[model samples]
Target: MILLIPAYEPDDRLIALVTSIRTAAPDVHILIVDDGSGGAYGAVFDGARGLGATVIGHQANRGKGAALKSGFRHAGRTHPGEAIVCADCDGQHDVDDILRVADRVRTARTSMVLGARQFSGRVPVRSRFGNAVTRLLVRLATRLSLQDTQTGLRGYPASMVAWLQTVDGDRFEYELNLLLHATGAGYAVEEVEIATIYLEGNASSHFRPVADSVRIYAPLLRFLLSSLGAFVVDTAALLVLVALTGALLPAVVGARVLSSTVNFLVNRTLVFARGTDKPVRTAAAQYWLLAGVLLAANYGLLLVLTQLGLGLLPAKVLTEAALWVTGYQVQRRFVFAPPRASAVERPVAEPSRALGADVR
Candidate 1:
């Protein structure tokens, strides 16, 4: 097992943590990436090395995701098929919890094990508030109920390292992207509850709440933009057609056809194309099926809202707001899902010694 930590401007807490882990599990290989912490923090990295860890240094600070990828590349070349668990260096993760996650990875080698934290009493307000909002948005965006959407401690099997290395994100958003795309790449996320520790209101955390939040929610934002564009097109067509034809059925049909086509093209070409590889016909079919259902549901909801004393414009807005998240979830999970891996990529027929067991 390899314990990979990414540290920047760290203090004795990092050194103490390394020492304690080495004392408890002497055989475990510790790899710490000094993310350009500079000369002042050299003593801490030196102390970690003195305790028998291999410290890799970069001249300039890269983000946590980059540091992790650096460690992963090193592990892939040196340790090859070994299990690796990542933990934060700011003392939030207990060594025992790290070991537990490692053990789970050893058994469930095909799964990505997450050391999820339970934010109960005495949690920092920022931590609590950030997690709560993120969790809700993640659920709406992906239809996945994750207990901890932003936990840094996670375990990855050797088989997943190649795919993990390809996942984009230089900062905190990278972790969220991994979780969001894990299922599409045929990996399941298993969450193991861990203790939540915050030091001095989480001041040690380098996350810029506003900036990082935008990056983390970038996918949802793009989807919203696409949907808004489609809505505008659809509304304009509907009003024009209604005025010209004086028939609701023809107006709705024309508007839906034009709007859905625009939406499909935009989403296929821009929003989801980066992460998805499903064939156009397959995706289009699923998209139209969802659009048909949503079209009916949307019109019905608008009518219902209007009947309940809301104005027509207000009702339309309320109805769109209600279905916006549902639209994103369906389009992401069903329409743009990647195809299953080929036999060579799957290798499910034979037992994978590299992954340890058939946790699938």
Candidate 2:
């Protein structure tokens, strides 16, 4: 497997990181994407070359996304059969985890793998809230649960490079953009728990939560409008069902199932269909997953809002809005992101592991 490390004006810490990687995985190919660090820092990379690392230089600073693209292109040319793992150059990821993901990559064909971090250790408040909010948005988009939206440490099949080349968007939004593209293509994305080494409490971190989040939330924002319409359809159907049957639970559940299905269909075609190859069965499976979750979220929210004294009508209104936003996020991250072709070119014709389940 090949590991792509994108760096800009990398410090001594990054040098140490490369050295550590060398010690951990001697055979692993390391590509350092130098985003216009200039001649002043060329020698630092020179040191890396001496340590047995392959350095790919960019004459100018491109965003993180561009750097990753460069690395993917390099890997495609140099190591076609190897898995591609993307890790940040900020030294926040453990080298051990890189090796671990590499091991999984051998078996995880046709699936995108994520390295999930433990949030219990001094997570920034803004980070926690942002992740929670974004996680919900991703869930709604793709019908999958992702613990971290901005994680830079990830692995994917090499074919993803060709798939992502079809999409646009650079800068910090690149990774999230990749995820959206991948999930849209019907590829499964699953997370592997890993340790995060946040040195000195992330003193060198460059993440701007608010700004980056706006970029990350781009897919979700578009999906939200569609989901809102779905909610209205659900509400109207629910009221009609209640009028006919006077059965709140069954009526609400039926209406929600119908509405969420509309949402899933729209999302599948409009939002995610742009780059998906998920087998028809994969879509059906994901649809069922999405339906179950939507029922739980929408119904659960209504129940809680009623208990909180918001009353049924007002509560339904508020709850519906909340659930739509929540559902959109999940779908983006899990259902339609990081674009890749199904392991089999025609997954619908013959369902296989490449269809029903992600190779995670």
Candidate 3:
């Protein structure tokens, strides 16, 4: 197993972590990526190197994702088919927990092992809130019940390194993207509980709360905005057509036709196109088929609600809201799914033991 640490302008905590790991598991190979730490941090890298870690340097500071990709590339070339466990250099992850995750990866060679932290005692407020929100969003998006969506300690078998390099994002968002795509790429997620350590209230972390949060939530946010735009177009057209013709059915059909076209175009070209290889024609056909079913459901629901004494506008809003989740799921899983790949049979390994209860 190879331990990959991605460090950018790290302090002595990195050296301490390396030393502890070297002491704990002398045979485990340690690979550190100096993500453009520059000449000032030379002593720190040298100190880690002195402890027998192979250091790879970048000319300038790339993001954490880039640093990880560099490490993955190095591991692919040097230690092919070896399990790699990635831990943060901020001294947040315990050496023992890292080793446990590594062991899990070794047993479940096709699974992504995550060292999940239980935020039970004395956690930083920002860290707690961030993980809570991200965990919820990740669960909603990918249907994966992850306790720690933002944990930096993760393990991947060597087979996933090439695919990891292709995942988008150059910052913290990259890690979340990995979780979002893991199952779809035929990798099972296994969690090993780990201690939650926040040294100096996590001051060593380089994550920018506002900027990185935006990047992390960009995919969902973009889809939301696109849906909102389409809703606006649909509502406006419905009201206008209803006013001109004094007919509800024609207005609904015309509005849906217009909005569906706009939505399909936006979703196909922008929202759900990343990492997907489905042809435009195929996606459009599938989208329209789903859209037609949704339109029928939308009109039926709207009609029933209006007949049951709700205002036309209120009923339209309720109907659309009810169908929103279905539309998003169909578009995501069917209309814009990644190219179909043969299923790889995963060996069913014994369940990993949970060391602690999940706090979030």
Q: Whose TM-score is greatest here?
A: 3
RMSD of each: 6.2, 8.9, 7.7
**Model 2 worst lDDT window (10 residues):** 351-360
Clashes of each: 0, 38, 0
Identify the candidate with maximal lDDT: 3
Candidate 1's displacement at residue 200, Å, is 1.8
TM-score between model 1 and native: 0.83
Q: Estimate each model's TM-score.
A: 0.83, 0.67, 0.86
Candidate 1, residues 132-249, lDDT tens digits: the string is 8888887777666889988989999888876777676878888988877777677888889998888887889889889988988887778889999998998889779978997766
Runs in model 3 deviating more than 4 A are 241-251, 273-277, 303-309, 337-360
Candidate 3's displacement at residue 254, Å, is: 2.8
Task: Supply candidate 2's per-residue lDDT for 300.
Answer: 80
lDDT of 3 by residue, 255-299 (tens): 999999998889877888752487778887898899889989988
**Which parts of model 2 are misplaced by more than 4 Å?**
225-360
> Which segments of candidate 1 are over 4 A away from where they belong?
273-323, 333-360
